[model samples]
Target: MDTKISVVENGALKRVGKVFAEAFGQTPALLVADGNTLKAGGFETLRSLKEAGIVVRQYIFPSNPQPYADEYAIQIVHETLKQDNSIAVVLGSGTLNDITKRASSELDRPYMVVATAPSVDGYTSYGAAVSIGGFKQTLPCAAPLVVLADTKVLCKAPTDMTASGFGDCMAKFTAGMDWILADLLGVHPIRKDVWDMVQTPLRKVYKKRSSIARREASAIGILFDALSASGFAMQIMHDSRPASGAEHLISHVWEMEHLSKDGLPVSHGFKVAVGTMTIRYLYDQLKMVDINSISLIGGESWADRERAVRSFFKDPKVAEQTVVIAKKKFLEGEALSKRRETLLSIFPTLIKRIDEQLPPYAELKEAMRMNGAPVSPEDIASNLEGLRHAVTGAQMIRDRYTVLDLFYELGIFDQALESLQLM
Candidate 1:
């Protein structure tokens, strides 16, 4: 639960090299970054390490720069860790940091992150999502030994990236709700400290919606603080449940489908943003949990679920692999079913419970827009199909106790699809 990295003033990134020097003695640093980030922040990081009397070695991901976490990337980072006995220093956020965190953990080397954006909460999480044998999965890993986010530079990050971060942060609202539901059903034990650590900053960000839009120094700083808190929560729980939810699953499904326009991959937070809208809409329509409708649910058979799995992956082997990951990694079957009923049985009345602990959706949307985030699904991409795909896939990727899963279990998925069309 100790958050190692510090988000300091603008010029502090240049001092990271020296800080590492003092912590681990004068040693070389293996700097890992992407092509764009290398230009934006990598050069300065390299210079700072050299000036601080530490040896420097750099390794950027290969080719025309596609940011992903696959076997090839994991192997490359592993090689870099072995090439020299230097501590790994990742200079970008999310994808780059995830790949490095997994690779260095495998190499058993200490690692640190210098975040370039107010991005996803994964900055300090202990697990990494990677495609080991073609299926996207979150493999267990360790948290970074340190995290450094320079707020000045982060405030100026691309609007879309900032928006994605907000989407990821907003996810905590529904995600926490799902966790509480699971707790009520005794599906899993809840950790109150971990939950509050992730949820507290959410209220603060919404309260300063106007200031956040101005990108005032204090606003961006506070936003980043909230983002970091989620990471620390993951470190404490050693699970993403405190942060990720049905929204993240949708993003993964998009990734597997290779769903891009003209070959450009979408941002993770963008997909999650749209997914958040889809799930929230579903939540709004429920008349009741309808515990008796569980038996009326369609596609409860293994063959039926497998068919949905086929739609997600082309290779039959990959399809089987996908099912295996879902079954093993995600908590499914009886437990999720019972919890869905308990949560839904509470229904519209539970809205009061959710409101008591979370910010109003409208206020949160304003905070995100002011912070340069997507306010709706349409704000993320060009078409509604992408949003549809994100919603359906979000349901498939995780076994978390979220409202989306509740909708699917209660036979309202089709109706939800119809509602999405209206949107």
Candidate 2:
């Protein structure tokens, strides 16, 4: 909602200087980018801004180790901006955008982004998902004042980055279903407007899988638009519930643990892609479950859950912090009974809604495969056992009411894991 101007088209980058000049009247700007994105759109953006008579400075990060949105990165950007009055113009996808978003917010100045890739939905979202200390969390920040995404630039992005965007876009399917579960159970109700804003455009992007795989410009533009729509939905709702669910939590677990493959950190979209498939499979299994035949049982005690949380999070600070979160959602005795009863009573409706909400697992898998997104945990440098651990660990780290919490509260957490047979 904070984004005043958004242009997604071929050659939109050409308008960067004019747009920024119109908005800020030739305000001096800081162009933040890493080595890769700097090559992608940095020079063009710089030229465009200067042509419009805007003075500019550059903060080019070395791309070798690849920058991540952590506190250290934020401090550098914040200090850089603190030394001058220049507003920022970020030139990358997720990490650079997040770093600049947080730093700009800390400085109480607006910023813009020239997207080199359609790699994430955070471009128009109100919060920066960054690692503070060792824990990954969403830090409150303002959205960009303007977003300029060039399809030409986007179509040239590494195939994996586009695949990552596809994965993140595809995640909306399971994310929506998770919201349906929470809505139906009367825990968190759905907002139809925000739902339509995100889900409506999601289907259009999913239909362009083959085109996206070929790096077709129009389809890639559509994907960029859809990703931005999700961000706008988040901005409007001030919550990620409309765009993220258990799948994101799964990714969050890997993020906190710094999951990596082949010596490089895994991309967020790739991790979420795997999490999307896992959640869909879990939904598939849930469909076959006979709620009536299952007996309600007691859940873990708060002390036991606290111990598990502390044991799972190796970082003492993260563990100490997560123990409090774990306690907030731990259910037992009558509280657990009421939740299970509500689930049983609504089991038929839940299944029906899930059927209507989620696409067939095979169809979903093939779509992701077409986009070159990860279809399995191994594809993201994670194994089934690691995934299972992440799924359960996900519930403890966030108080978000998701299907993961549902299974735990229903006293069938281990049973669900056993059914998955992640081995």
Candidate 3:
């Protein structure tokens, strides 16, 4: 709702300056981009701003290692922006936008984005995903004031980028299911409007996999729209509950571990795509779970959980902080007993909801294949060992009640890990 203008037109870049002038009244702008994104639309973006009589400054990152949205990169942008009062105009996808978003928020200035690819849904989201102190976290930030994209540019983006966008979009299936699970478990309830805002557009995008793979303009536009819609949903909820879930947590673990291929960190969506498949597989396995045979862990003592957190994080400070967060949601004693009882009572309903909310695992895999998104850990250079570690670490790192937590609570985490190995 805070995003005032969103354009996905054919030559949106050509009119960006005019649009900005009309919306914000010719404010001085700080155009941010990287070497790659600069080559994509830098000249035109500058020319457009100039034509509209807007003074603009440029901050372009070199392509060699690329600009990571890490603490160092954020500080660089923050320091530069602090020297002036120019409004930030980020001209890239994902990381660049996240960096600018956080930097602008630190300065208490509104920023705009001109998307070069439909590679992520962070464009209009209210948090910047950054790696700081060796921990990957989402730093709260303001949503972009305006989001503009040229369908022509998005359609011509590298195939992997578009596929990554699709993968991120597809993650909504699991994210939605996780929210529903959390709601039923009394963790977090779903808001009808927010759920509809993200899920409705997602269904349409999912049906256009082939069109997206072929780079059809209409399909690409739809993908972009869905991605933006996801961002808006997150903004409205003031959290990523509606847009991220177990899959995203898995991605964060891989990110912190520096999982990479060809000496470059894996793309966020690609990691998430594999994670989506893994989570989907876990759900499939859950279908065959005989609740009668499974036994719940009575409850973990705070000391035991703290020790687990410490071991998982390997950093005393981070583990301490994690325990504090975990304490907020960790159940024990009567609460745990009640949770178990409630879970058993709703088992049938939960199964029904899972069946209704998730697409078949094979169907999801085929969709990824159709769109060229990774469908397995191997595709992203991750192994079962690393993935198993990620699954465990994911639950420890977040207090969110996802399927990982469900299995852990049910004392079947080892079984789930084994299933992942076999898969």
Candidate 4:
């Protein structure tokens, strides 16, 4: 909601000066970018700002290792920005933008992003996915004051990056399904306007898979729009429930484990793409489940659940924190039994919703394939065993009510895990 301006144009980079001047009015700006983004839009961005008579400073991250949105990275940027009164202007995708967002928030200042790729929807969202002490978490922050994207730059991004963006956008299918499920269970109801904002454009982009794969400007612009809309949806909800669900949880598990290739962590979209496939597959399997056979296995005792959380996290401090967070949502005994009854009572409707909300698993895979996005675990350098582990870890880490929670509650999680075949 804090984001006041949103620009998507063929030559948006050239409007950096006018837009920045209009918003902040001659305030010195701190331009943040990695070496790659700096090369891509730095010159033009700087020229535009100077032409508008805006004083600007540049903070370029080295490209070799690629900057991460981790505590160390946040600290470095925060330290640098604290020295000046410059408004932050991030000029990259996920990580750089997250770094700037968190740092600016710490300084009680707002920032803007000049998105180089449609990579992820964190740009206008008021949270930063950052790792501290090796644990991944979405730290609260201010949404960008402006989100500017140039289709010309976006279309030229690496095919995998754009495809990754498509994958992230596509995950909205399952995200929406999860929200609907939560709504049904009285966990969190959907906001109709936010739902329409995210879901409508999502369907449009999903239909343009080939165009996105071909790097067409129009298609890429739509992808950016949908991604930004997703951020706005999250903003409206004041939480990620509207935009992230089980798929993102899987990505979070992978992040905690540092899943990587060629010494670099996998992109968020690539991980979520595979997560989307996994969740869709689970939903497909859900169709075959016999609700009558889903006997109530009493929920784990809090002490036992706490132990599992501690063991799963492998960090005493983090495990302690997780237990405190989990305590609120961890059900037991009569509560668990009643929950099972409620789930049983709603089983038919739940199935109908799943059927209505999800595309066929094969169809979803085809869409991902059409966009050159990774459609399987192996494509993202992960295997079923590893993903199963991630899925388990994901369920334990977050108390959010997702399909994963439903499956876990019903004692069908292991069965569903075993059902996954090589894709």
TM-score computed on alpha carbons, candidate 1: 0.84
Q: Model 3 TM-score?
A: 0.94
| TM-score list, all predictions | 0.84, 0.95, 0.94, 0.94
Looking at model 3, the pairs that clash are: none
The lDDT per prediction is: 0.72, 0.89, 0.87, 0.87
Query: Model 4 misses residue 197 by how many Å?
Result: 1.6
Please list the Cα RMSD from the true structure of every candidate, rounded to 1 decimal place.
3.9, 1.8, 2.0, 2.0
1-423: candidate 2 lDDT, tens digit per residue? 798989998998889999998878867999999999989988889999999999998999999888988999999999999988999999999989999999999999999999998898989999998988766788999999999999999999988888999999999999999999999889899999999999989999988888888999999999999999999999998888999999999998988888999988899899999989989988877877778766676567887888888889888988988998887877788878887889999888888888788888889999999898998888987887998899988888877888888788777788778876742
Residue-pair clashes per prediction, in order, are: 4, 0, 0, 0
Worst 10 residues of 1 by lDDT: 289-298
* Candidate 1: regions farther than 4 A off: 1-5, 60-68, 132-135, 287-314, 321-345, 375-389
Q: Identify the leading candidate in terms of lDDT.
A: 2
Stretches > 4 Å off in candidate 3: 79-84, 133-135, 295-303
Q: Please state the error at residue 146 of candidate 4 in Å.
A: 1.0
Query: Tens digit of lDDT per residue, candidate 3, span 137-201?
Result: 88988899999998988988888888899999999999998898889977798899999999999
